[model samples]
Target: MTARFDVAVVGLGAMGSAALAFLAARGVKAIGFDAYFPAHALSSSHGDSRLIRLGYFEDPSYVPLLKRAYQNWRSLEARLRTDILTITGVLQIGAPDGKIVSGTRSSCELHGLAHEALDKAEMARRFPAFQLDDHEIGLLDPQGGYLRPEAAVMGYLKLAAEDGAVLHFGEKVTAVEPDDAGVTIVSDTGQYRVKKIVVATGSWIAELVPQLRRAAVPIRQVVAWYQPQDGFATQPQRMPCFLRDEGAEGSYFGFPAIGVDGVKIGRHAHFREPIDPNQPNPPVNEADLALLDGFIRKRVPGAAGLRVKATTCRYTMLPSEDFLLDHMPGEKNVVVASPCSGHGFKFTSVIGEILADLAIDGQTDLPIDAFSFARI
Candidate 1:
């Protein structure tokens, strides 16, 4: 026997879980499917934490969506009775003219956001953990912080189930065929028919949607956690999340230890080598450690202590590294959402709501033109 639903959400990681949760809350007959269980470490959403910042350096146009995303995140926390977002302030540091510093200042100025501009000395005084060159400056965004990725995913999935969403975990979706009336989704367990479909599959997008194989490429990324030494404090009160544009070495971002007794750091532009998500993730190597060592030695104080652990994840990137959200060509019944390039988890709250809106209403009030696949 086949199952039927008003909407079938494929890949219930971040976006799909939110879509299902929203639809189910609305009393829509929604069903969700995922290749792995929610909050599983195999995918992008498994990382312990994700940074949330209002001063987006990628583009200032993201501020509006971010504002809405913040509200949604708060609402989700209230609804689920779970603590998710933690505001520890954020510092975007680099040369005054660099993308990380200038772009963030531009966004804050344009959006009328509250932020502080600190020179090298002020930065050192305010955040003792950071080591800066004399010419470097820091743009501190007080609203920026981190989100617990695994907990957020589980919360959304749990609420979705309570709201009447039928979820099939560890069920691989083999194909999604759109028809005149709706969409037909075939999985390893059974077939599902729905009036609409939302494809939020992250790294495995190409495997299911052949047309997007070339557009969405998955890149291997590694994140490492290190115990702070004597001088620096990893606690939220002292150290905030940080991003630095290290000129040639590439951009690096990290968070102060939350529950763990270590700080987490990852290169935003390192090890972007393409990988097949279907294959086992390669183990973290010494070269990765050496790369991070350079950053820690130069910038972060007391971050060179014992290296606790490191893990790898896939980053599905577009050429521009912006998000990709749109409907399948000639098929309005199916909406495709790939909000991840690298920094996407923070926006999951609004992305899910947008996916639900697109799948049900066929339109959304949010500004998503920047992520339209038509541009590609």
Candidate 2:
């Protein structure tokens, strides 16, 4: 069959939606498919918020990309005429020698980012609601806060539609075949042929592209919302998003009670339990609450009382904990764009631009060598 569009984007979450938005903005004939509707909680990019920060602790190389991401996010906000990012500042807290603390400091110093290093006493005095240990310090990124994941997904999908991109919601793509001329996609509903294909399939990535099965595995994750105590203020005005590198115990992160009454938090470490993405997520149980309760009671002052809500999400993790953004091997038109290891949501803004560039021209000026398949 002849190609029906210039590009076909699979997985309509952050990456796919953003890619379609940019591609359609450039007048490319684009079609996007999602197993469920965009912003649905079935996959990642759900929940109310995801952290976005300037001083990246993952690696210093991500600093440049993060800068572009911030700009792209704001540009999307301006065009959409809605709020996507809320700047509540971010407190990157951990032991002075911890990974997050040291890495954040290194990135800040290397990039000359605006940040303040806070000692334990200072952090306690300024952020009195958080009970920090004497050994723990903080790196405050003034340009850090949370992004509304669901809102961003829907916003981009809306803009993509306005720009003339065809989107198929609740249509699960079953197979993807790359050919010399382009790529072919088979979904439960129908079939499609396009000049290029970008796969951002999240947890179902392995099912669509079996070659990445070893490189990317979906692990179940848990996030909980807790009601605060009387004395502590969980409001956004007084509280900033925080990260705690708790050594072997695992790193924890949380946001203030902004739109919701309860403070929200999640552990950076996965449950070590891999699951079939085709199945429904396992329910949150006592074991899960027990794990987070330990941290809540010790670290966060106001979160000790009731656990209002607990939810399950998937993190398609690459073994190295980096991202995969390169084209599929020997396939000119297929791009594997998943397995961000839980930290890729913040970069979705620029990643969409890179995907559009690759889909149309087979190359991008973005420095994504770190996310190439060679490392996989």
Per-candidate Cα RMSD to the true structure, in Å, reads 1.4, 1.2
lDDT of 1: 0.86
Steric clash count of candidate 1: 0
For each candidate, the alpha-carbon lDDT, in order, equals 0.86, 0.88
lDDT of 1 at 124: 69
Expressed as tens digits, the lDDT of each residue in 1-376 for candidate 1 is: 2437899999988878888888888888999998888767668888788999998888999999999999999999999888999999999989989988899999999999999989988876778888899999888999999998888888998889999898888899998988888888889988878899998898888776677888888888998888888434657787889999888778999998675648889999477888888888888899998988777877886676787888888888888888877788889998888847888899999988888888888888999988887776
TM-score of 1: 0.97
Residue pairs in candidate 1 whose N, alpha carbon or C atoms collide under 3 angstroms: none
Query: What TM-scores do the predictions have?
Result: 0.97, 0.98
* Residue pairs that clash (backbone atoms under 3 angstroms), model 2: none
Runs in model 2 lying further than 4 Å from the true structure: none
State the local distance difference test value for candidate 2.
0.88
